[model samples]
Target: MDRYVSVKDIEQAALSLLPKGARDYYKSGATDEQTLAENKLAFQRLRIRPKCLVGVERCDLRTRALGSEVSMPVGISPTAMQRMAHPEGELANARAAQEAGTIFTLSTIATSSIEEVAKAAPTATKWFQLYIYNDREVTRNLVRRAEIAGFKAIALTVDTPLFGIRRADVRNKFTLPPHLRLANFDGHLSTKIQSTDGGSGLNKYVENLFDKSLTWDEVKWLKSITSLPIIAKGVLRGDDAVKAIEAGCSAILVSNHGARQLDGVPASIEALPEIVEAVKGYNVEVYLDGGVLTGTDVFKAIALGAKMVFVGRPALWGLTVGGQAGVKRMLDIFRTELEYTLQIAGTPTIADITRDMVRHESAYSKL
Candidate 1:
């Protein structure tokens, strides 16, 4: 509705619109959902130390990622089976991102094919999120297709060697509705995701198709195969961030798979500073996702050294509510809030968002 001014409002609308099974599959995290709750909560725990008496008339949110100029530091993270939420699915999402001048990452399991999304938003800056399937040829073909279709980068998701145990999906026996298939696979591979008697069909699909033995060497191989920059998503630990750089990754996405693949991992925000510190000398850039729902969250993320902050569920929520226009509204809200935040914090430009602008609440509580 037009009254929906915030992401939470859109999220409520989406939850109300989607079926129980699809809603839960989209919203629920891994076993226990501890990290899931913590992801957002951690942002609340971070206190912003705003400055005063500084002229903040103009605020610029534009930033560059992987050499592409985006209107803002906030971008869309890849989420699967979007048609379950909206008819246009990834196509709408891509168009929305293009309209907002931000990057749109399409999931490997997206309901729309690479060529379809490319055709839908030819000028959009897109990154293809890759799940290294067991079949190397299949994975290579996906990369080749993305490059051919003009996707700028490859975001290799490393956390999901196997799918997480989401109880909601298990209880609902989540499977793609009979009508929807993984459009990316279409004729190139089996589009069918077999329904399971119990548990999520997705978990079974991932378990059977994903390469469990994936290693850093695989990252090297990915670089060798494609000229597009590779971004290693799901990196939390500082050591792992360093290793990703060593593996020839151009960027590191500090994520916990939206807390979907693990029960108790540090929130992406909490893990960001250390990763930023670890990658100091390296040329790699760091981005963050998981629990970035507001412009304040984006501001905090940039202050904490993330070049950009991504939102997965929020984008889906927007898509569910009103297709491309809804997604555009969601991004506009973030941009507006972030501008207000920058004005209040005395930071006029993205580069002005320094570490002193934010502090962990715990640091203050200790005193």
Candidate 2:
């Protein structure tokens, strides 16, 4: 724990330990990786205006999200495969989420299934990420399984239209190692579907599975099948956030799929203010999931009107480093930094984080 002081420190250590293909796939985002780089750079564009002599004391990081009291406004984002990084995979992630008293999302492309993860970490707050497939029953079955397994919500990711323009996976010819398997569909699909022509392994998988015709109508169909609240992920604009509410979604995760789905679009943080302005009066809660790496980043998002912020690559990096313990350490470190930031930033309670704490960089025309 003393050795890994920064997120980059843990990431570098994990990359050194994992196999070449696995490391590259886990670290690399879409083509040219401009968006991934922009995700971090977006945070740099914000400046925190800490109040002086505010008498901040006894900081409380706890907040309510989706009608549940989470220890913090941070949740684990869904990534494709985790076992590739560590044998424990999503289970380790689940354990960390449970220990932190936060929500953890399981990807549809996860190496571990919902039931398996639920069994592994029963007390963890679970949310399943759904990528609508061509097979309607497959989609229904997944939702049904999650509902039965006690997952609190369904985070339906709608941004990826047949995966991203990830050139790294194409050249690397990335495929799951022999040891790793998609536990949910292993026995169901005899041969794996690979879309190598336009993209590669991932593109092939996206084509074979991702149902392109999916629309807001499907959200209703899904709602009819389960009692869980639907969270629309991958939103970057205010209109879409409003539509999600109109579609009966209880929450909307403001993201660009960790800047993995689209290139040259605005970063998650940059898009936050607009969406917050659009849905300020709506009962819907707003959440974010990109470029979040520090406790201050969480505080900044809260100031910018985000109810909670999700961490994507960092948690996976933890899983890559030392499985469950590594993930827990990552969360713990962030918690420590966040408490430290809140005290120094003069915020004594989560409610004290106001819009004035954030100063948009663009307001200053240095140019």
Candidate 3:
């Protein structure tokens, strides 16, 4: 733990701690994983052009999202079955997010129930991540329960009409452990995800239950059901970003579902600038997730116009290492690195981070 100074270090530690099946599920991406690898590489392809001689004073990392102030612009993205990483699961994650003063987005498929997580971290600024099920009533019920639990917003993931073909899961025949269940749907849905002899049980569960017909009209219908702001996640194309705003989404998250949904999509960061351009003056906040691993990555995303950045695998790595404490440490590293980056870049605050501060390395290649 003392030796884990970077997110990558924490990832290696977590991989060592998690079971083979659980680890594969958490780490593997779709088909060939080209998008997954590119998501991280995309960040490196951009070069930061810093300003100098600005009065170096105190740096402020505070930013607002969905009408609430968070200590930093980094938030935890929703991931399912966290107990596979640590016993405390989403409970640890929620507490850490609250303590860090950032948002914690809970998955619709989390091991901890909405009521249970709310009970565990009553004051955490929570956002519920929705996966629209085949039954409209089930989806409605989940949204209502999240509202009742005091979640601040709804991040509706739109990319996964069906689960991606993650070969590792298929090969491993991955299934939720018998001890765990999708706690959110205890009686209302099938909590148990049974293993198939040949393929991933989770994939079968999603195919059987998730509604493939979801479209822009469904987004509008969701808005009618919840007073909380809706954030459309997994949008990569500029056109799709516009449609989300037209459908009354309060924000758009430029993501490729962490490259777990599509193997060939552009990296989320690469998609951010275009989406930001598309939604210009639309009163909609833009955010990004997928392969964000460092403060530099967070800073770069904001420079390109993301209001905030979300991390999924990093938080799970933290939880796997030391539960809540480990998760907090992971966030602390981000904060510390971000503050250093701000100082060196001569950007004193979040607003000071500007588009000119970064250029895609390709722009320099022709020079």
Candidate 4:
């Protein structure tokens, strides 16, 4: 465990250990992946302002997210196909989140079924990520299953109308390993990923199965079917955030599908301020997830008004490196870093982290 002290270390080990098909599929982003690189690069451009001589002692990292008390502002974002990284898969990821006292979001296309994960981490604060399917019954059934399984909220993914053009997946002809299935769906739907002449099999599966003609009305329709709070994921613009709030989303996740769905969008952190400002006084929580690699990255997002931040690849990297223990270690790294950040930066509590604590690097050039 000491050998892998950082998330990047785990990521390197994970990438090296995974098979070519799954490796490329997990790492690659849309088209040229410009946004992928920018997500982290954007964070680097922000500078944190530290304060001193405040008699700082103990720093608290606990906060409330989605009406639940989390150990910290960090949570695990939904990333598909965990079994590709390890044999335990989503089960390991969920258990780690439970141990860390944070939330774990299960993807609609997870390798583990809703019931299986619920039983695995019955006490974990779990949320289910949903993708509206072309088949309305499939969508309803998924929501029902998640509700019955004790998932706390529905993170409705609104970004992926169609899968992005990830060149690596196409080149690798990405398909799930024979042993794994998209466990939530039935027989053929679960096993749809296969090498196709058209390119990435997963892309084809989404195109054929996902609903593309969705509009804001879909949110209302979803609300009608289930009582779980909806979180509008993949929002980048302020207008969309307002619309999400207006259409009854209790929270907004500012993301660009981890830069996998689109290439030219802003980093999730870069897009956080607008959404945060837009949703002010709306009784909505705004979270960001993209290139959150370190505790400073988490601090910057919170200072900029993000209610919480999530990590997708980093958690997967942990899972790949050591399954549940690896994920727990990865989270502990963030927790420790965040605690140190609070104490050193002179913001001893989550509320002390304000907009003034962070400044864009470009802002200093004006002086």
How many residue pairs clash (N, CA or C atoms closer than 3 angstroms) in each of the candidate models, in the order given? 0, 1, 0, 0
TM-score of the candidate numbered 4?
Answer: 0.99
The lowest-lDDT stretch of 10 consecutive residues in candidate 4 is 190-199
lDDT string, candidate 4, 211-253, tens digits: 8899988999999999999999999999999988888899999
217 in model 1: Cα distance from truth in Å?
Answer: 0.1
TM-score of each: 0.98, 0.96, 0.98, 0.99
Clashing pairs in 1: none
* Tens-digit per-residue lDDT, 1-367, candidate 1: 5678899999999999999989999999999999999999999999999989899888899999999999999999999999999999999999999999999999999999999999999999999999998889999999999999999999999888898899999998888887788988855344446477678888877767899999999999999999999999999999998888899999999999999998889999999999999999999889999999888999999999999999999999999999999999999999999999999989999999999899999898889
> lDDT for model 1, on a 0 to 1 scale?
0.93
Candidate 4, superposed: residue stretches over 4 Å from native: none
Off by over 4 Å in 3: none
Tens-digit lDDT track of model 2 for 1-367:
6689877788889888988877888778777778888888888878888888989758898999888889988889999789888888999999999999998999988889889999988998889998788888988988999989999999999787578877777788877665666766755341253323444566666666777788888888888888899999998999988888888899989999877677888889989999999998899999998988888888899999999999989998999888888998888888888898888989988898999998868876675
Residues forming the 10-long window of minimal summed lDDT in candidate 3: 186-195
lDDT of 3 by residue, 87-120 (tens): 8899999999999999999999999999999998
